[model samples]
Target chain A: MDFKELDPILHSQLRLAVVSLLISVREAEFTFLKEKTNSTAGNLSVQINKLKDAGYIEVTKQFSKNYPQTICKITKKGIESFEDYVKALQSYMNPGGN
Target chain B: MQPVYCFINRLFKPKFQSMQSENFSPKDSLLLIDSMINQAKNRFTENGFLYLLWGWLIFISAVSHFILLKTRLLKHPEMIWMSCWVAIIFQIIYLVRKNKKEKVKTYSDGIIDNIWMCFGICMMVLIIIVSRNNLWIYMYPFTLMIYGIPTFLSGVTMQFTPLKIGGISCWALAILSTITLPIYYLLLLAAAVLIAWIIPGYLLRKKFKNQH
Candidate 1:
């Protein structure tokens, strides 16, 4: 009778896209995610922080080739949440009885 | 979920040029997810440039070796493979540059790199094995066998048919080289590169360009 409630952490389009991209790759740079999401630095930084706060992603600050690099990686918890979110989405889309 | 959580988080505090995605419906969310996943799936550019470079270099080298052997022109025929050593240096430079240029490193990329690394190790071992024992005479046959391992696995992983077929072709040529005389092994090497590396290299590059 009622649809499943989607996780708010994954509900937003930008955040969801970030998670989706991270799921495929082992790790990605902050700049790489920014480039892929096509979001402004300020905005991407904010969204990344949100995901990090939720324990869904691990952001590491390191130096590569004498330049500061921020790398983002999805955690096991993140993958589980993403999979659950997709299932909820499917349930809502299907409106099934199974 | 309530919008109260958004207030606590530092995210969504600043309004953006396109904040519409911040508040989207289920259908909109679905579309975004689809596009994002597809974007990740479509990244298939790796080794196309090297394949062509190595393919042409080795192809020419193998052919030259065959010609030298047939004509008895050169006092030292092993000099042809020396070009491969130089080409290997160039390949290293190219790979390092490409690694730096790649923004996102996918899981498949790591696996592919390992496969090629293993191939390199095997090649080194073959060189050692050949120098020590004369029984494993026709070097190309053994080389082709080593070549098939990575090429076939690479094709299987990427699901690229040309590579898979090329790999099979290499194995077949390796077997053929064993049955025939050592003189024909060079020709077999040429054919293997043409089918397994050069042709597939061009096709992969074409596919990459078409996607971009």
Candidate 2:
């Protein structure tokens, strides 16, 4: 049986979790994501930068009440990639096209 | 024995190969997606501040207007509604602060915000139409009907049963107002605010506290 390749960018656990959260909410702040994913600031920052580099998400930084805030939003390309990844996973589960 | 081990390894090799290096199999990935979506969905909880604010404001105005009219204590019972302008200024300040403090903006939030904004604009236009046409006698029923729109839509968007019930209550009260005397219209308006805003507002506050 032939298998579809998953998007390498979304294959990792943390990255997938971030995309999944962003997909539903559309926009979230850095603190919100870090809290929800239960990830360290350092690690989440890295994964977020990677996603940004892949054009899967956009990050915005600004000051809110004298404190820095980082907001992230998923782009069209990211949404398409996420949809494709899910379809590929479905094919793996049902190789016979059931 | 060696051949049996090799056969078993060969059978599992493809499955292991299909899994991510982090040991997340297809099933695990799907589960993660489901969970994260739920987490994001549940993260939004309404504090019900605005609902209670408007609800109490309308409720007090209606009741007080009815009392002033019945007692002939005031020449202009309608003047009570002017207090709403003051509340409007307060609402603006509150919203600005709330928006500043908000860390995220969900699609549902955006839709609900627009629904209320539309409701506000509609109410303003309605007041203008009624005043210009001298249709104040028919105002209560019409106002109640308008109240139902946003209340119902917000309930559906948030999946909150109380707000849905409140919306239905507003419509029922509107129908009842049409059959009653014009003098009693203020009471019906009071009832609408109590049901549609106050009760749901309190319940929403409780839910927000519990969730937070």
Candidate 3:
């Protein structure tokens, strides 16, 4: 098994997908990321918390029209991690698995 | 008659009335709050100063142009030309200063907005210079029409109604100036400023201010 240093929690396909989407989207609400990743609220919340704890993404809560809001944005550290992940993933996919 | 009756009855009948159900709930109230927060977060992430700069410059210039144009004293051809140059100098400085802080790739829309403002300023200078060449007096109104075209285009492109209104006002005044008194040019300038610049500027300022 060709493997490289990767965050165990983020190595999963779904979390990786979530991080990728967040990086490009500037900022996304919990609902939008849920729809985009096709993940349930419980699953996404757990993944987001993991990312937030890692300092890869920042989550802010606010009120809009008397309703609670949670917005997620990818951090600079997150962007760096994503780039590294892509490079590592690329190495794994190469013909010789270098 | 029976077939016609049957067709009419079929058309009037509500299809899928039984299938229609309110089983799904509306979007969560919490999501909207999150969205607004998200929107704010994104706005902050983007170049906030530059967006304000682009929005403010267009609006202020439009308003100032309208107000100054309305004054009978400013209608003096020499005064108009002098004021035009001063405004240009100020704008060139503003543009240079604003450019310093702006990162080219981060705010593309702001760059486009700045381009339009520059075009408007350049056209104003050209209009003033051409008016002095008595040889082009016959063509002066035409030049004015040309001047207004950029304003109109900028307005439409930016979705700022005032600029569009100003542009139309210029064309109308260009037509009106040919037969009417020179003082009428002043009046037309007033209309252009009011319609194209001042009102819209006020609206934008209010809009962004509320967002903060």
Clashes counted in candidate 3 amount to: 3
Q: Number of the top candidate by lDDT? A: 2
For chain B alone, what TM-score does every candidate structure achieve against the true structure?
A: 0.86, 0.87, 0.51
Interface RMSD of structure candidate 3 (Å) = 17.6
* 2 against 3, candidate with superior TM-score: 2
Q: Candidate 3 — which residues are off by over 4 angstroms?
A: A1-98, B1-77, B101-111, B114-140
Considering lDDT, where higher is better, how would the candidates rank from best to worst? 2, 1, 3
Question: What fraction of native interface contacts is shared by candidate 3?
Answer: 0.00
Ranking by DockQ: 2, 1, 3
Tens digits of per-residue lDDT for model 3, B1-212: 24433332343235313322211111221233235334333432222233244334433543454456566445543333345556558767876765433211123245446666776677667756766765444444664576476667756655667667767877887888789665345455545445555555565556556644
Over 4 Å off, model 2: B1-21
Provide DockQ values for all models, in the order shown.
0.44, 0.55, 0.03
- Model 1 CA lDDT for position B37: 78
lDDT of 2 by residue, A12-82 (tens): 77899999999998689998889988989998998899899999999999888899989999999999999
Q: Report the C-alpha displacement of residue B142, candidate 2, in angstroms.
A: 0.5
Docking class of 1: acceptable
Instruction: Put down candidate 3 lDDT per residue, A9-29, tens digits, no spaces.
Output: 445445666676665555667
Error in Å for residue A49 of model 2: 1.1
Off by over 4 Å in 1: A1-5, A61-69, A94-97, B1-22
lDDT of each: 0.83, 0.87, 0.55
